[model samples]
Target: MTEGRDDRGVAQTGSNARKVFIKTYGCQMNVYDSQRMGDALGSDGYQPTETMEDADLILLNTCHIREKAAEKIYSELGRIRLLKAERANEGRELRVGVAGCVAQAEGHEIIARAPAVDLVIGPQTYHRLPQALAKVARGERVVDIDHAVEDKFDHLPASQAGQIRGRGVAAFLTVQEGCDKFCTFCVVPYTRGAEVSRPLAQILEEARRLVAAGVREITLLGQNVNAWESSDAQGRAIGLGGLVRQLAEIPNLLRLRYTTSHPRDMDDALIAAHRDLPALMPYLHLPVQSGSDRILKAMNRRHTAADYLRLLDRIRAARPDIALSGDFIVGFPGETDADFEDTLTLIREVGYASAFSFKYSPRPGTPGATMEGHVDEGVKDERLQHLQALLRDQQAAFARAQVGRRMPVLIEKHGRHPGQMIGRSPFLIPVVLPASAGAIGAVAEVRIESVRPNSLMAEGAEAMPEAMRLRA
Candidate 1:
């Protein structure tokens, strides 16, 4: 085992602490991972820096989901090399590293291609970063790609910052890591390893701490959130609903939500949470990927269009006002016009509030990458446009419906305009209103005056209705 360590200099203390700049790319999961990495490094006496030029260490946290994500990382490395050279000319040593999925996917190839990088650690191995840095200090180019089982969360220090971006009303709390679904088009299972969940007690503790820190709304994060299962202290298995119910008991925690769930994992407990827990927000982001049964089967998604529709029906039955979001892939391998139509039909039936639609791009080491009958790029682009058009229409309709409705908006921060504060409604709609900076972190009743394509124009109230106010 190579003990990862930074040989550049001894750990700093007090005002002389070394600065580390972590540049993160890709999903919300990466954001959470970067925060944990920051927490771990902070424990090791490495304070964060905002600018690369002023940092002693630079970590590039990457994503490998898209086709050119690795290439983009290489491009960034080239730019960083110039800065490293400049520092070397000034008799200073700067440690550069790459972390996250790209590091896991490329491994030593990254070091070979980018010699300026002192360390390369994968997402699974971030817990070993301090040791990796020590190896770097010893003049060894370190690469830690071990997919071993370890609780990286245990190494993280408690979060010291409050109201990220000074928007104190909401925060994202990661309760789970990795995925097991193994969707053929996704690289998550390979990069993030197995479906490992944090213990319920740990999550609850973190949730309580977040709420105490002025976080009113918490979005529970996971690659497949609804698939969450952890044993209690007495070793009894509990699922997501139980977790939501437990977190709801936290005083001052006004709203709860989770995301990026699978259609197959839409279990009874999660649906019941929507019905029984008033704190749980009435919105669900379920990624169906594709609608055609054949394409879904090829993608190894295992759920048919009908299965997804049934799940949607159950969810709506639980919360009639629940707004829905989804993921769609256009022009997947072996997909026909009929398959594309099936996706459009599914979207129409679900009447999604919003959706993310993308053209299929093969990722290396994934099952879909080797599949035959790849669709033409032009065809994929055409289908993607068609899908987006329909989604835009539906989203506009949903936004329009919110007009004149009173929604509780948790004031996050000042908007682009002066005297305007922006926040999110329980449905996660961005609402901008004319209000004072003092309103930040407090929930205010906002009447939706008008709807833009992406945001809502709202007005703050002198007094709000009790029913519209969210209570913990």
Candidate 2:
């Protein structure tokens, strides 16, 4: 049972339930982790609160994927520090904690730097958050970053049924965690540890619970999501493709998707699943960090530009309407004008529906950091602008092409206007149309009427008949 709040909407101090405010940073996986952390703390009489000011404990679930993301955590801590002090002055107790990759990477340093942080728990050890909080209650600062011996997932309690329904129709379920590839410019392998796939039974159990809670869509998540592999009930080994096929069997699961794939892990069985699974969305986010062979070699991606293109060719052949997305990095060490052009050439060749491009920043302890002939910031900036402009054009073109097409859209939430509602297309594009609040969790077919800068406009299908819509 949840604790009662006062008429002013603030949690009462005398209430048995303590409120926790979690600020999640980076990735769908972090979102999943935050929810699990809440579940873990739920056992200790804590409930979630949106407003940090009313929180008895505040957690910053951080990401250390990039240098900027890591530094941003510290910047946020500075603001939280003031809030903690203010709450203390009022004689109200407020505890601050940091969790996730940044905590794993620099555990001791974070506690030393931010005196306000009472507990620091890493991604692998967050299942022990209740125990860590106990230590903090004894007037001790706690740092738990060790790769625990027991499986964290096995220890985590299932989210309360009400909590699951409150998360909305679309949800993220982490089937895998960590990385083993160890790319030169990456920190995931170090911070998240080696690759590990959750047992198939555990995943199915969770997926079933999600569906039971009215979740219509589930995006399987991981550091390298496509790399997930586990054995079936008969003890037969299966990969992500097999997992998707199994998940599609769950009744009322209208949409299935996974993200942040590695090029090397795009096996033939997974491609076949794309062709066969109707519930799987026609979108993929596979990161091919660079197009130049030299840069790819230096980065230890182990796959060349041609190899990536060939893989895409096979994938596109399997699912003709699949919208392609990729990740690109500009100005890696020793990258030249020709190397940058090669990236542009590849981008044009693939014609990405959408992509993420960044000016490369060196991460400490990664091989690329100490590599020779790092490009100038001015050049990185120039190349990034050029790449982004191209990607924007492609995205705009893709949006334009979708105009006049009829497609199924999963109504996610109510839009800004009273009658307006937003839904996600099969290609993962946001489509806004007039819809009733009752239609929020239904999948309706709508004709794309026009294109907005960031979303598609739909019409002529608002009054969806009971038979036409799949209600959650």
**Candidate 2, clashing residue pairs?**
none
TM-score of each: 0.92, 0.94
Cα TM-score of candidate 2: 0.94
How does residue 148 of candidate 1 score in lDDT? 71
Candidate number with greatest lDDT: 2
Candidate 1 per-residue C-alpha lDDT over 85-120 given as tens digits, one digit per residue, 9 for 90 to 100:
999999998999999999999999999999789999
Error of 2 at 221 (Å): 0.4
Mark the 10 consecutive residues where model 1 has the least summed lDDT: 1-10
lDDT of residue 116 for candidate 1 = 86
Candidate 2 deviant stretches above 4 angstroms: 4-16, 436-438, 460-472
lDDT of 1 at 153: 56
Q: Alpha carbon lDDT of residue 180, candidate 1?
A: 88
Q: What is the lDDT of candidate 1?
A: 0.84
